[model samples]
Target: MTTALGLVAGVLTTASWLPQLRRSWRTRSTDDLAWSYLVMLSAGVGLWLTYGVAVADVAVVAANAVTLAALGALIALKGVGRGREEAAR
Candidate 1:
């Protein structure tokens, strides 16, 4: 079952972000993350989500949706922390 395989792969890939998300939340800092990279990644993930929806692929939709949420949280944390970071300098 390719669908099962895809779901497995999706889970793995989606789970990979947990560490980073945990770290970011714990530290409340995204200093090591670049704005450009985040934007690009979000864009790509968004596209994947759109494609998944368009084609009705549950695996892609589920994976990208979760990934996008994580990315959104990361971006928000990064933006909020930026002010403090700059003020510190």
Candidate 2:
């Protein structure tokens, strides 16, 4: 079914980032992460979320929504860490 396929695709795409998320959380380090790439990915995910809503795609919406939240948290943490480092200098 198309819905199942979409769900699988969404899952695969979203889950692909979990390892990095876990690593970042565990190490409490975003040092190796690229800020530009993360910002771009967040924006891309936002668009995907919008597309999902537009097309009434439940799988896309759910997957992108969760990914956005997770990435957003990571971005916030990175920003705060960067700010602290900059302040310390």
Candidate 3:
């Protein structure tokens, strides 16, 4: 039961990023997103992944892995988009 609960919580929190990811991909606009926030979030998620691995928790491991992927993509897109904007100027 605890594992199940953990999975549910993980899914919910992980899914929270889906919409933002989709929107950013579609629009190629991360003007509203903060670089500092994404950097810190990715760092924090990395720590969570490390903790999950140490603790051998499937839910934590799975969720943080997926989240880190999403965050990575978002960060890449933001960087590329910013670069293009700067190049245009």
Candidate 4:
């Protein structure tokens, strides 16, 4: 039951970011997203993934894995876009 609860919570928390991810991907707009925040969040999620792997918790592993991927993509998009904007200047 605890594991099930964890999975449910993980799903909810992870899914919460889906809309933002989708929107960012569609619009390629991340001007409002902060670089430091994304970096810190990615770091924190990486730690959670490490903990999940260490303990062999499927829910944590899955959630953090997907979250990290999405975060990585967003960061890449934001970074590249920012670079392009600077180059255009």
Separately for all candidates shown, the number of backbone clashes (residues 3 or more apart, or on different chains) is 0, 0, 0, 0
**Model 4 error, position 34 (Å):** 0.8
User: For residues 1-89, could you state the per-residue lDDT of candidate 4 as single tens digits?
Assistant: 98788778989999988899889989989999999999999999999999999999887899999999989989999988899999999
Candidate 4 Cα errors over 4 Å, as ranges:
none
Clash pairs, candidate 2, are none
Q: In model 3, which runs have C-alpha deviations exceeding 4 angstroms?
A: none
RMSD of 2: 1.7
**TM-score of every candidate relative to the true structure:** 0.89, 0.84, 0.93, 0.90
Cand. 2 Cα-lDDT:
0.88
Screening candidate 3 with a backbone cut-off below 3 angstroms (N, C-alpha, C), the clashing residue pairs are none
Root-mean-square deviation per candidate: 1.4, 1.7, 1.1, 1.3
Best by lDDT: 3
lDDT of 3 by residue, 1-89 (tens): 98788778889999988998999999999989999999999999999999999999877899999999999999999999999999999
Which scores higher on lDDT, 3 or 4? 3
Q: Give the number of colliding residue pairs in candidate 4.
A: 0
Candidate 4 residue pairs that clash: none
lDDT order of candidates, best first?
A: 3, 1, 4, 2
Scored by TM-score, the top model is 3
lDDT of 4: 0.93
Over 1-89, each residue of candidate 1 has an lDDT whose tens digit, in order, gives 98788778899999998999999999997989999999999999999999999999888899999999999999999998998878999
Distance (Å) between predicted and true CA of 86, model 2? 1.8
| Residue 19 lDDT in candidate 2 | 83
